[model samples]
Target chain A: MEVKLSLFGFGNVGKTVARVLLEKEAFFRERYGVEFKVVSIADTSGTVWLPEGIDLREALTVKETFGKLSAWTNDYEVYNFTPKEAVQEIDADIVIDVTNDKNAHEWHLTALRDEKAVVTSNKPPLAFHYAELREEAEKRNIPYLFEATVMAGTPIITLLRHGLRGDTVGRIEAVLNATTTFILSEMEKGLDFDDALKEAQKLGIAERDPSGDILGIDAGYKATILHCLAFEPITFDMASVKGIVEVTPGEIERAKAKGKTIRLVATIEEGRIVVGPKEIPKNSPLAVESHENVAVIKTDLLGKLVIKGAGAGLKETASGVVSDIVMAALMMR
Target chain B: MEVKLSLFGFGNVGKTVARVLLEKEAFFRERYGVEFKVVSIADTSGTVWLPEGIDLREALTVKETFGKLSAWTNDYEVYNFTPKEAVQEIDADIVIDVTNDKNAHEWHLTALRDEKAVVTSNKPPLAFHYAELREEAEKRNIPYLFEATVMAGTPIITLLRHGLRGDTVGRIEAVLNATTTFILSEMEKGLDFDDALKEAQKLGIAERDPSGDILGIDAGYKATILHCLAFEPITFDMASVKGIVEVTPGEIERAKAKGKTIRLVATIEEGRIVVGPKEIPKNSPLAVESHENVAVIKTDLLGKLVIKGAGAGLKETASGVVSDIVMAALMMR
Candidate 1:
């Protein structure tokens, strides 16, 4: 099958997914007998359709110059397209949704309902509209992959989905945030809390607002997703959760003196979800690393299942997007 | 299709595989819509076949007392029956080759040749007869899985065979041997190397002779197998490499003072395979927790890929056996 990929975003992750597939094309075909055609790119910059191939260099040039594909007008109209129109009518095997969060963008919701194979890093769709999206995907037997949503390139959801699919997972515990963990690690090294936050932001490790990360909302969101996948699915509002911003560098110093480190922990126990900061002993596995690292688990008949990896990174996050595309292709097949 | 599973050895991994399958009989049918029947058992002691269904409890009971199915009188009589008489002749849909490593006896070779789906934790057969066995399975068009052969259920081979199949792996730097890594971790922690070796033996973490692990022979075996899978179809002897058994605790302490932790690193760079202890920075993921943890790569267009999990333990190892059985069933359908 000639795989046609309808990419829904052109951000760092979206671009990386495209590059990896194009760069490793031979490896895929020679080894797995799978191939892909990058037919489209859609983002705020604009939309471009290069049916046979999206000349990545040319596309980058076009987008960079005009700041939008819509501004680029040439005789290259062989497969000209728009974002919403592409989702509706593209003769593609999979529609990869890498769109940034916009609560009102109903294109993806409609695509899922229409049975398009979706591979995404966009969490809003799943976080807010999981039921409707999942129902439609199942009803039509198309795959809905969101590996990048929870943890980039890590197999926590999959470890439970396939590795322990039938077993009843009782509890899940994890250090699921890297920005805050990085902040905490830095604080341990004597950097003041405000300075540590600034350093993380300077390194592009934390968001500008840093509200989602420092407040623990991001970890809480990921934990909610983990809970849905690991056990029975449930809906939880992101508001009721408290973030770890309350914990300061002073607390970190106190803990380091006692041979401990402060880490943001997330858990689903006794049917309730929790996310916060905790003081851990020095020798524990959680104390072993710094920077964009994350680890968590599922407890069951198999014992506590643990997974740790790049919680966030340009490349690591992009890896998940590519993984989602791979899975999407498999589903289309 | 009636799925018949033949046990070539009623050992720990074999029993655990059977046990989980039996325990999850209803689950297997409900979730995957497949059923497994323990149709045969064989060991050096003797062989037995249960055409209808094996009294798994009774089989376990008898095996515990007699050390083999060959020693069970009723099972012996039942053994010589048509199903039993055809110990070598029994046509099974899948064969669990868990025999002790004398290259896991000829039964494994026979199982592979017969085109019966083969899943084994035993390293010898796969290590020595990889090409031939894989050739036979390919000719017969059946699945041959040995996830346990490398990293147990740690997802090592699965990543190559499926997940990372499209990515060209440049180097596979690994901490492959758990026992040796564990011993070294203890040595680095100030335990006398000899005393740590003794402690490992007492804890059943090290083999009686400990040559395979301490001498790096076992990890060498795994590295060879990984090389064949990741690099080219190649065979090389690992005996010539210097092993970790000679490292003293004083040496470990010295390395630690220099901010290093010891890990048995296995590397394949430009077609050469090397396995030995490398002192890592205090924060490398290679400073893994406990025994049986392994990390590896797919060093191509997408960069380094790492996997970590239990590389040993009966239940963890048996999970691979079950994965094989499931894949075999998928192929049969």
Candidate 2:
């Protein structure tokens, strides 16, 4: 089976996805009996479409050298071909959205309208329009998977949906955001909030304007997505949000003195989603290491199942998106 | 779609599976659009086969009251009908083997030869004959699923196979046996090994003769199964093993004083399988609560992923088996 994919976004995660796909092409074919081809790539600069499949190695080199897809010397690049146009025009089986674009949902809807499956690592589309987008895909009998949205490539969503299918989930306590967890863990090491945030930025773990992460919106988006998937469809606004700004180093020290750790935890239970800095026992599963995410799902049948792993990283997020793409391709077959 | 099932066991896990299936019948039908009819149940006493579908509630009541399917005061019970006869003569789409019968692999082979999918919570079959059983099912294009074999309902196998499909796994450190973990945790709390064994037996966590669990053979079987799934196939005899018989309370206390916990850990890496009591940081993910299992998978792409949950419980194992049944039904569709 040949699966053609159109990726929207050429940032670190998108570029990493292309690299993984290219690197694992033969492995995928031999293991899953499927060949994945990137039919189009659309970024802020422009879109590059090739029905014969875009040269991912060349695209990576072009984007890295020139910082734009349209700068490719090849004639396949089109300056005005927007993401929406790429979704509508490209003859692809699945459309992958790794962009932070607010209007990425529109492209997702357009792709679903064209009866193509959508796989995304972008949380906004799911955190905001889960029901609408999910219904669109369901109506078309297509997949709209975002396994990377919550905890990168940890497979929490798959565990909840497939592994624990008939089990009733009671509560979920999670450390969802890598940025806040990293900051909080650093703060536990006696680093002040400002210094921790600066270190996160230097490591590219946080953005230049880290308001989304510091303010808990990023974790809230993830909480919303998780709540929607595990329970019901919930918009970001429905979640009560709190961040790590108020968690001072003194407070972290105080918590540590009591054998506890202050972590930005997300609690989803009884249709209520809450994201805030909470003090958990240092030995609890929710108190994971720096930058790692953990979801402690309390199910009626299986008790508490903790899934902990890398919550952020270019390769991790790309791994998640590519897995989603593989599942989508298998579903198509 | 209706999926016919033949259950080959009537112990705790098998009975729990029946109860769960009966309770979740409507849920499975409404969710997966498949009605699962348990057509036959073969136990030590005899076999009960109903062509249309066995009345699970009545079967449960009869088994509880009479202690044997053959003792049921109904026309369906057949005293002379062995498990082999049931597998060969009965019409079932999927055969579920939850027995500890050493020759359960033969029934699985027969099921595969008849082109029926196989789901099992039995570890002996896979531990001793993984390649043979797997090849048989693969040749017949049938699913020989054993999600419940290792960590009961933790879904570690699925995580390695499907969740981390394209990623390369580096090493796996797992606390796979609940009996030893419970014993060790009890020993850490000042109980002697014999006292802890008695407590575990009283709590039904360990068998009367728990040589397998205490001698590390149980964990060895699970480790062998995990190794075969994550890497190449290896029987239980190919791995090095050490049980928990020698870990004294003094030793556990010393480890605790050093902020470490003694867990019967299974290490599978570089084609080597080792099961023994390893001292790890008390704060590590592998140092889970009593009766809990944790699998720390170090993948090339995702770094380390830890999955922790109930390692042994009737309901948890039932959940894993039923989920596999659901997946098998979906695949048949």
Candidate 3:
């Protein structure tokens, strides 16, 4: 059987996902007994449509050079379709949403209503409207997987969902955001906060608009999504978030003097959610290095399980999206 | 729908599985839309056959007092049947094998041939005959899951099998044996080797015949099983095993003086498997506490992933078995 995929957003993460899918096309077909085709792609500039199947290789090359899918002229129809319009109008078996837009909730709900399996790296829909989206997917018996939303492709979501069945989770403490973690590690080396932020920007670890990364909003979104999946449903507004924007050199030195390190930790325990900078022991799992994410999940039956891996990267995040695509394909079969 | 289960080995892990299943019966049915019943239980002494679901509460009570399923006599037929004979003769939808016997290969093959889904914590079948057993299960389209075989309910098997589908694994270094880990931690605390071994025995962490654990045979078996899951097929005989019996306190102290710790590490890299005592840095993922197991898997796309959790315990091992059971049930549905 063939699974037709409709993709939204052609940015860095989106292009990487396309490249990986094309690279591993033959492996999927031969091993998993399923073939995949990218039928439609929609980005900020325009949309490209080929009902039969778009040439993924050509699409990636065109997007790489021209930064838009509309520039691809390989005998395909192009239109100025917004992501919402593309999701509602395009006919595909699965929809891959990689857009960072905060208002993509209605588009996801539309896809689920159309009976299409949705796999996303975008956290806005899941963080804000998890309960509603889940209800829609469950009503349609379609999958709504967002493995790449939390910790890139580390399989934390899948592990909690499928592997730890029948075990009750007690609490979760995690270092989720990578940008702040990088800045904090730099600060620990005697660099001031502004210089540390500049270094992170030079290294391409921090975004051009680093407000979300520094204000604890990114980690708060992740905490909301994780809480919805692991324990119960909670919206993004319910979390009490505090970012690392207020940390000073004196605080870092004080923590070091006490044999501790300051890490921006996201904690979900006993129906309470908080994201802030906390001082923990130097060797604790939460005190990870720059660009590294770690989560320590306490459970009743299995004790404490610590999962540590890369929190965010282009290829890493793409790998997670591709893994979800494979899972959705298998489930469809 | 109710799924019929036949369990072998009424030991610590087995009884805990039964108790957990009964305690969570309503939860499974209401949440997952499935119910399970233990129809038959077999131990060394005899077999208890209850086609109409055994009383799990009573069975646990009886096993707690007598240490055998043969002593339970509410209203079930007891017969002298070997594990292999019971597996072949019983009409079950799934078979749960927790027996410690290292020669239960024929029994597992027979269960697969009988078209029964097999979930096991026993490593012998997987460590020795993984290729053969997997072939049998694939031929019949049944699930042959052994999640509890390696790390005891930590989700390593499921992560490799279902989660990291599009990623390529490069290497794996793990602390897999809990008994030796406990003894080594004690040795690190200035206790002599003999006193550490005695403490481990007194704490019920090591068996009376601790050759399998102290000699690295246990870790070697786990390495074989992990190899089969992650990379390719290989039997237990292919691994080069060396136990920690030769490690002295002097060596540990020497390593400590150099800011390192001696740990029994099982390594699988570039088609090679070895289990032995190696000196690693103090804060490495492999430097875990007593009774804690950690696996650091290096992948091409996802970078390095470290999973740490309890390696051995009654509840932890049973949680893995129950998780597998839930997976099998979902697959059946």
Per-residue lDDT of candidate 2, residues B1-333 (tens digit): 989999989878889999999998887888779999998888888888888998899888888988888788546757566667788899999999999888888888888999989999988999999999988987777888988998898788778767876577889999999899889988988899999999999999899999989999989999999889888788999989999999988889889999999999999996899999999997787887777899999987788898988898889888789889988888777
Of the pair 2 and 3, which is ahead by lDDT?
3
TM-score of 1: 0.86
**CAPRI-style docking class of model 1 based on DockQ:** incorrect
Q: How do all models score by TM-score? A: 0.86, 0.94, 0.96
lDDT of 2 by residue, A86-194 (tens): 7877899999999998878988999998989998999899899999998998888898888888899989877876787767679999999889888888888889999
The worst-scoring run of ten residues by lDDT in candidate 2 chain B lies at: B73-82
Per-residue lDDT of candidate 1, residues B189-257 (tens digit): 678878889989999989899988888878877887888787665554632355897787777888888
Off by over 4 Å in 2: A74-76, A189-195, A248-254, B139-141, B189-192, B248-254
Error of 2 at B163 (Å): 1.1
Candidate 2: docking tier: medium
Which order, best to worst by TM-score? 3, 2, 1
| Full ranking by DockQ | 3, 2, 1
What are the DockQ scores of the candidates, in order? 0.21, 0.65, 0.81
